[model samples]
Target: MSVDSDIISTLTQRAKQRPRRIILPEHGDERVLQAVCRLASNGAVVPVLLDAPTTDTATIPDNVEIFSRRSDAAQWRDRAAAELFARRAAKGTTAEQARASLDNPLLLAALLVGLGYVDGGVAGSVATTADVLRAGLHGVGLADDAHQVSSFFLMALADGRLLSYGDCGVIPDPDAEALADIAIATAAGHQRLTGAEPRVALLSFSTRGSAQHSKVDKVREAFDIVRRRQPSLRVDGELQFDAAFDPIVAQKKAPNSAVAGAANVFIFPDLDAGNIAYKITQRIGGAKALGPLLQGFARPWMDLSRGCSADDIADVAVIASLLGD
Candidate 1:
């Protein structure tokens, strides 16, 4: 399905009102360069290009600031190295290892973010998800309140509705507590990003007491934990996909559920289910999946799909900028 243009427009408008300085680190990729130009031209952000080739200056917009490791290395290297060493000192990372890591563009962009050189950053177009996330964790670190980092997709349906699917790209097998945290974080993120009230659904193979298994029990336990943690949040769980999505099915399967048939945030039981569900929704169901956005971090840093287009990178940069608000 095509993306909901209204969502992008709204986000773009919001970002333009307060253009953020966002770093794009994949300088070698044409797609990333294209996105940087778009962001600069639109005035939606101050796009910072890391290690961009000087030969490409004519193609690069004037508003885009080029960060060169060759000439600018002396200014940031020592400071970045010191910060990295401090953060990873417990892991036996030597000062030399920390200094050498600054050469990596992804880690350098993340360190710039940690050092407040930019509002946030977007990467992963030419990098693996593992590498992108590792840079974010080692450089930016997690929020004080966050126990673990998680990811979520901003799914824009063909019908012009936006939904959130969580832990699709991180945490392979979250237990009950972790699952609950994912739900809470995704719900909060949904509200923040979309300006819509969050109705969360903990997805399962069974709806209520229709069937029983350890997996079903885990969903149920997660539901309880979410309730205990955020009593004011509208949430229900142990619901089949149909029951959670279709009002007709919800009426028959879980009539009294607070979030049945109206959920905007969906928490999958594990990475396998979340990943498969999002791909199916994007491929067969014709929805546009805008993320795999990293959350629960101290600051905003995003992970783009390796196969993403220039438009996808531009849109994610806007989203990352807005998350900084």
Candidate 2:
């Protein structure tokens, strides 16, 4: 989800309209259950525990749906090899293909979603990054129109500012065009998660002609590409962190950038800055780090770190429900 208040409201509307029954991966832990419970009690979709052992049910909410993981391991899809090969391969599937797919945990989970055995897959607390992407990519697949499935983080400043920090958790160093695409996606995601019509600031050390180098030039070029891609969007770039977030600093530095100080969404030029900025804010600055939103998907799938609390699970569950089809 996004930090934009409007995006928050949008999720609220989704909770009211089409609540889902998300599928938890096999033997998924207690923390995850707690998260599911928080959202369900508050009118989000009911959680459907999948592949979880029977002994574990005692700790889960009584009303939540539970799918026997043991059964799904063999029953979700039969035409292929894995019982849960998603709806995408109901026909023309080979056992060898299914076997290879199941080798990937993400793919295995995605198969369940693909076959409609589950509404969505929420893993990551117990799997590797490779596992998460491989499954989601194979099972859910990308939107026919999208070229890639990148990631984003939903960050909220303690001072009541909310915005997205992106591709930090996914791509290491995106090219100018990839950066441009990420910006557009992040802005749209901001609207979806926070309901804010984004005024984006593409942040770098260099603000509008203040400096010129490969790094600065990248930000400048990406900004141009993003603007061309989405002319209706209000985005500008090559801005310093201060100029992007502090209006006074922006006026003094750039003098003419629409994004200076008026910005609500910031697009980082690279991973080093984006990842470092968010960590510092989350750790030292006392801000709430809501998400690595996992945007650019056809379905409402999200991930969790194994170290996360039950509260984290519940919040993300609500977010996934809010993004449902």
| Clash number for each model | 2, 17
Give all TM-scores, in the order shown: 0.92, 0.83
lDDT of each: 0.89, 0.71
Stretches of candidate 1 off by over 4 Å are: 1-4, 69-75
Q: Write one digit per residue (lDDT tens) for candidate 1, span 216-287.
A: 999999999999999999999999888999999999999999989888899999999999999999999888
Residue 318 error, candidate 2, Å: 1.4
TM-score of 1: 0.92
* Candidate 2 per-residue C-alpha lDDT over 48-127 given as tens digits, one digit per residue, 9 for 90 to 100: 76544545566666677655434444555453245433443667666676676665546666666656666666777787
Which candidate number maximizes TM-score?
1
Q: Where in model 2 is the C-alpha error above 4 Å?
A: 1-18, 68-93, 99-105, 114-119
